[model samples]
Target: MLVRGKADRASRPNLLGDLDIPSGLSASVGISEFTYRKGQEVYSENDPAEYVYQVRKGAVRRYKLLSDGRRQIGAFHLSGDIFGLENALVHRLSAEAVVETSVRLFKRQSLENGAETDANVFHRLLSMTTKNLRHAEDHMLLLGRKSSVEKVAAFLLEMDGRLTSAGLLSLPMGRRDIADYLGLTLETVSRAVNQLQREAVLKFIGKTHREIVILDRLRLSSFDIPG
Candidate 1:
């Protein structure tokens, strides 16, 4: 069963409104809000795709486990990002909170029902799916063809655009999480970051390794392989 709770006014702006889903649809179809602690599982792979989620605060990591006990992270969803809209009835990847997180959940069945009666809802659903597809395609390119340096550079640029504040890119996940997402080992990711720092491309801040400042945007961009 979907847990029910009130979504504060502060979090209203981060809901389905960004996807252009009618506000009326949320109340009429029933929306649930869930709060998860850091490293907690939001949902597991092959679980029923009962709800679509929008991050209200913090970050989420979507990943898959291999038969041989290895793991591959697909993406990290940040605040205001929607995820878990699978094409089938089950989620292919498991999602977990990278930090203490709150998310607004929409019943997938209710959403599908709304799409049947509303053209706008249908269009928005299609648009969201297309956006996910494009991201997957880009990730595939990065995993399949991009060099180690290029992959790390692209990752930094992505986080810079998504999470940078006051000139610092505060990454919510650690090196191991980043390595899984980029299909590289932890040592390789560390070396790549160190190389970039050595070249004055970026600088680390504070004691935690999660915060960084991009000193040369153009130099960073040079390392990204064009698709």
Candidate 2:
């Protein structure tokens, strides 16, 4: 299914939007509250996933756990995005709210039942899944082929597009998380970031290492490989 653009008139309303779903459909969905302190687990792998979540605020990370305690973070879900969709039996990857966060949730059974009866809603869900898959595929290519600087540049560009505000971009995750996401070591991430700073691609802000100002948007876009 073709995903609708945010500015398109035909765009569907997100959970945070004002579009009114049918009462029957809306009744199947209800909000739930969850909180995770930094490094806390929201849900473990193989846990029964009774619901799928939409981020109301903050961020979440989904990752796979190896038997030897190695972890590969698959993706991060930020505000206005959805996550926690899983098979009927159990969750394949573990999810954790990246900070103190709250999410709006709908029961898995309810979502399935709603989907069975509502083609439009089902299409919307599938479209969301498709968008996620596309990002994962693009990230896989970045991980496999991109240089460390290129990867970091691509990551910054992505975050800039998705979350920048008034010339400043605030990273929701830490350097270690960024390293894992980019398939680089933390030192590598630091070096690439410092390089970007020295090159006037971005400006560092604050001592906490969360805020950055983009100095050259066009140059940053050039780092991403053509999709």
Candidate 3:
């Protein structure tokens, strides 16, 4: 269940952090904020694409169910990241809160209406679409061509760039989630992470290995290669 924030739109910092929506365009729409507990379902697959969301805090995972009853995670949306943006009528993947997450959302129609008359808004929307496409292309290569270590290295580098805080890369998802995202088995992912640690590329911090500190970023990047 979505627990909508009581604050009005005017009190919010920005309408769309990724889109950097114009103040005028944002004022015309009613943005609703909601908080979801860890493991809460945000939306199911094939649901009507009524809204687009921006992460205010915490993270979300978007995934699809495979034929053999396996879950394939397509993407992980971190703080300030956008999700559920769609040009189609329905969502392709189901979304769930990876942790206690807060998100701001607005109807998709508001953006559509704004884009019709505003070239700037239209361009921003196009840019976002292109970004998602690029990510999809990269993921395809990672899953099909990369080795287990390479996949884990690539994932660490990605989290380092996106959500690393105070020199520590604190990952929200677990081994199972990482395995699904990287198209690897849980043991493979675990071994890869341990290998990186043994090689002195990264050190596991905190009570769990999810809290990591990259000791040698260049070495980690070298493992990722083009994929």
Candidate 4:
């Protein structure tokens, strides 16, 4: 998605909201810029966690690999979201850019060192890690327990909130990725999407099927499984 000025700013959800970072910590850290094209791997599973990344533009996906090369996408990171915050020095999951994305990366060692000296930064990092864990837990429940239709509805709501701009929501990932994430087959994912469009809950921009327009949020939520 192309963005300009304030419109671009709104696309990102701030990770640093009300979180205090020591002034000294800011001066000690430096950021490197990296741009990734669609479907580019940011870092692979088992790679050394050298940096913590903050998205300056676009989205990312973090996923786990099974024994047979199947991947289950754990989360989708939108603008202003942080990824590559590892629980250890090595990454547990692989991360990839969903589009032409730019990220500001800071050395993990520097952050760790700064955190030792700054209580606020330490607390913020701990809190962020907990939040990521919680999100992963929630996604696991959704994937394991939700029906195919419910899964699609949940996915729509999430994408709508994250990527929609000017009342249009465009998905960067393909059907195979969506199926793997939702724990459904590709045909099932396509069928659910078609059903939603027919039911007037959503509409597509064109034959491409990438651009989605949600027509009725209330109806969409009604399809969500019992909490």
Runs of candidate 1 exceeding 4 Å displacement:
1-7, 14-16, 21-24
Q: Cα lDDT of model 2 overall?
A: 0.75
Candidate 4 lDDT, 59-111, residue by residue in tens: 88888988897878888888778889887889998999887888767778877
By summed lDDT, the worst window of 10 consecutive residues in model 2 runs over 1-10
lDDT by residue for model 2 (134-183), tens:
98897888787457888898888888888898888998899888887877
- Provide the lDDT at 196 for model 3: 91
Clashes of each: 0, 0, 0, 0
Model 3 lDDT per residue over 1-227, tens place: 77876656665657564455667877766778899999999899999999988888889999999999999999999887778988689999999999999888887898888889877778988887888888888888888755899998888888899988899889999999999999989999999999999999999887767899999999998998864
Q: Model 1 misses residue 117 by how many Å?
A: 1.3
Query: Model 4, 118: alpha-carbon shift in Å?
Result: 1.9
Least accurate stretch of 10 residues (summed lDDT) in model 1? Answer: 1-10
Model 1, span 1-227: residue lDDT tens? 23334556774654556555667776765667878888889999999999999888889999999898888999999998899999999999999999888887878888898788778888989888998999998888788745788899998998999999999999999999989999899999999999999999999999887999999999999999665
Supply the TM-score for candidate 2. Answer: 0.86
Model 1 clash pairs? none
Q: Which residue runs does candidate 2 get wrong by more than 4 Å?
A: 1-21
